[model samples]
Target: MATTWYAPYVAKASGWLSDAVNLADMAQGSTVNLAVTGLSRSGKTVFITSLIHNILSAVHNPNRMPLLNVVASNRLMGTWLEDAGANRLPRFRYQDNIEAMAAGAPLWPAGTDDLREIGIEMRFQPATAPGKLLSEISGTPATITIRIVDYPGEWLLDLPLLAQSYAEWSRATLRLYRRGIRAEAASEFLSFMGQHRHDEPASDEVAKQAHDLYRAFLIKARDAYGLSHLQPGRFLCPGTLADAPFLWFAPIDVPDNTHLAPNTLGALMQERYDTYKREVVARFYEDHFRWFSRQIVLVDVLRALLAGREAFEDQRLALESILQSFRYGSGSLFSKLLWGPHIDRVLFAATKADHVPDVQRDHLAELLRSMAAFPAIEAKSSSARFDVMPIASVISTVEDTQEIDGQRVQVVVGRPVGSDKQAKFFVGTVPIRPPRPDTWNAPFLNVPVFEPPVIDSSPVDGVAHINLDRALEFLVGDRLR
Candidate 1:
């Protein structure tokens, strides 16, 4: 691991300037940077699209979001998207996504692979009397600019690589692959890696072969076996770096104490790994992550549960590892003034709650909390407020009751993807905690993909959801005041 190259220099030169600019903004109005991320196929795109729709819609139809205090108190005056400016990051396609969902035959928006941003201006009356006095004196309503950033959760799994040496990462990754199901899926790649000699001179053909096989294994582990702990996530979703040599290295098996000679395969691989951390991972932290004041980590608990015991546990480990990136603690004012942004609030949300019956939603939330209780994560929990809840950004199912074996069972009814006919799905009760090996003997739950419910084209009606307002209130409610 290497120290971020620019940290010390930036701390010394820009500390006061950055603090003053932030303080000045806070006096007039506040800006909140909200980061939303989740694993592949975790419905992040849908969540963002639905959230924006609901907020903009609440401006005209306050009744749609009664759980949000600003709306319930009749203080939400207006909401609208502002121009993101030219030559900046691309804007999130809010209209295109909503239109797809509202079409005669709705479809889910495409999943995100690149970074995008959207800014919304929320104008509202001040909730407190003194704040109201200030607003009246200024002849303007209080405003908060909410900036939402969307990116792949795969990229997030790479953050921990910043603190790990190539040798350390290789040993850990190799050990993980030898475990229960991963051993079988990763056998081909493992065999190839074992055949190479790390001390030998570097060869492009050999390196490419190793990289290709390892990438193939990652894809199989994710798509076929439902594993979540894959590393160098960009290999799986290589947005713009598809052909770059920076992504051409693979982990090699080597003795812990061995030293590599110059120009050897081991030396070349280590150099590329260091370059990756210094360039790709560090730039992301500096540009995007360092500014986020609030974060939402979405999890597809139901999918993991359905995948079986091995997958459920793997997903848990991946989440616990990912949480390390948010572990900054409260420190001295001087340190805070000089340091980059520290996240004060984090929301670990179990998405697709609509896939299960209402009675089982609490179990979903509890499972997430249990997964997030790793020792390292719990230590950070003391510094920041962590909230765990179940949310469905878009409600695609309606509840119904069915008689089974002389008993009534709650079920969710919706149209499965690619099918014109609607069907009822019943996933067995979700465990409140991770189930032990012996107790996890139930059949895999057959949760079906659901089509989005028909929605009116107007944003005022908004999109139907579950717990989205409560989640929003917890993340940025105080800032709104």
Candidate 2:
């Protein structure tokens, strides 16, 4: 009976120990957050869906050999499943897209402002013993939560404003509208800037008008810029003035003294740009971006390069600007904020590589490396992850071959809307590694085969199954693990 008394104490101690173990497990299994950003029409949505699909496929498979093999080989833990906030991550939903898929039509994404958070649970099956396999597949399951924020790419431009002043932002915006390869509508905003500059000692109404004018111009440029996927969040809306007047600066104009009222249009534009950059973009970066552990920056490298030299240079400068914005360098104030944490890994992808022949895939990676231009890191240990891989989101499904004299060439065919389809040879080579400066001189197409599509379905003459799986691997592979 005396020895039995110790049993109660042991049970009490074990209860507390169990609670402690649960807490530790939670701390170790903290949720992983990822941000996916790319240019409009890049395969972001498809990639995310494919990643989820593959993970689900692996989880639900009755034949547990792959899981067993991975576990036995130490590639993974046991497998299980959880609700990846199935109802929450609306952006990843494929049900709405089935109509477009079934019809063999190009799919447009849902509007941007209405982005939804998606949560999925990744079930982890713990390994059997140190060596032995309990079962080829595990009957038990453990889970980790994955949270993702799906926003339209247009919103990505707002991230860099934290560092810029309104004047600087205005000058920069004006320069881009004037010298950049944007649509002509952007010029109208400049006229407003010119007028506001002549009004001395500007009144609040003048400043507000300039702010509204600048926003209107941005909206017009976005609409007319031939990039139709512009409506993400209404952050660009002219009148959400919670902290509105702060963004009421004007663009700076060169000195052309004609009966001046102080605070000219140039001044007004500069101030508004500064406020927008600082208050708006900075706030977004602070609120939405802090939790990201990984990020993928999708770019249209080939498209920009193909637009010829000036366009290429503009894109190059834009890339540099973007990279500098994200980097946690000495002068980067955002990085110093509680919300501005250093990104663990960043993957810069060249999208729609499938549009070109396989032979030139490596060249895309090389192009990306050249474009990245070696970000200035806080430390060498502060990793700057980058890659250039071809992804055909909406695949061109034709195996186009043509006879050039005596030689036969397999090509990819591209078509403008309502235009005749033209063929470009498929470069079978896939990208093998990240590009570097030295790689730039080499042929862009010679890299190793990254991943090729399996071609699950038939093409609609010119349409094909894009290498979306490869994109998924590049984007969420590590996260899946």
Q: What is the lDDT of candidate 1?
A: 0.81
| Candidate 1, position 457, lDDT | 62
What root-mean-square deviation over C-alphas does model 2 reach? Answer: 8.7
Candidate 1 per-residue C-alpha lDDT over 314-411 given as tens digits, one digit per residue, 9 for 90 to 100: 89888977776676555522134225767778898999999999999999999888876644554654345688999999999999999888889999
Model 2 C-alpha lDDT versus the unseen true structure: 0.49
TM-score of each model, in listed order: 0.90, 0.66
RMSD of each: 7.0, 8.7
* lDDT, candidate 2, 1-481, per-residue tens: 0223433454365553332223223223546676776654445665554444444444333232232233223344433234443453454554454334334444433433334455555555433331112122223333456665655555555555555544444446566666553435656666666664434665678777765665676565433342222221233532234345666654555443333334655455455555566665665666666667667776766655443444455456556655654566544554554344656667777776766666665578676776656543425454446555655555544457777668887666654333345435444333333333343322232212222233222211212334434444454454333
For model 2, what is the alpha-carbon lDDT of residue 37? 68
Q: What local lDDT does model 2 show for residue 446?
A: 24
Once fitted onto the true fold, the runs of candidate 1 whose alpha carbons sit more than 4 angstroms away are 1-27, 330-339, 374-382, 441-446
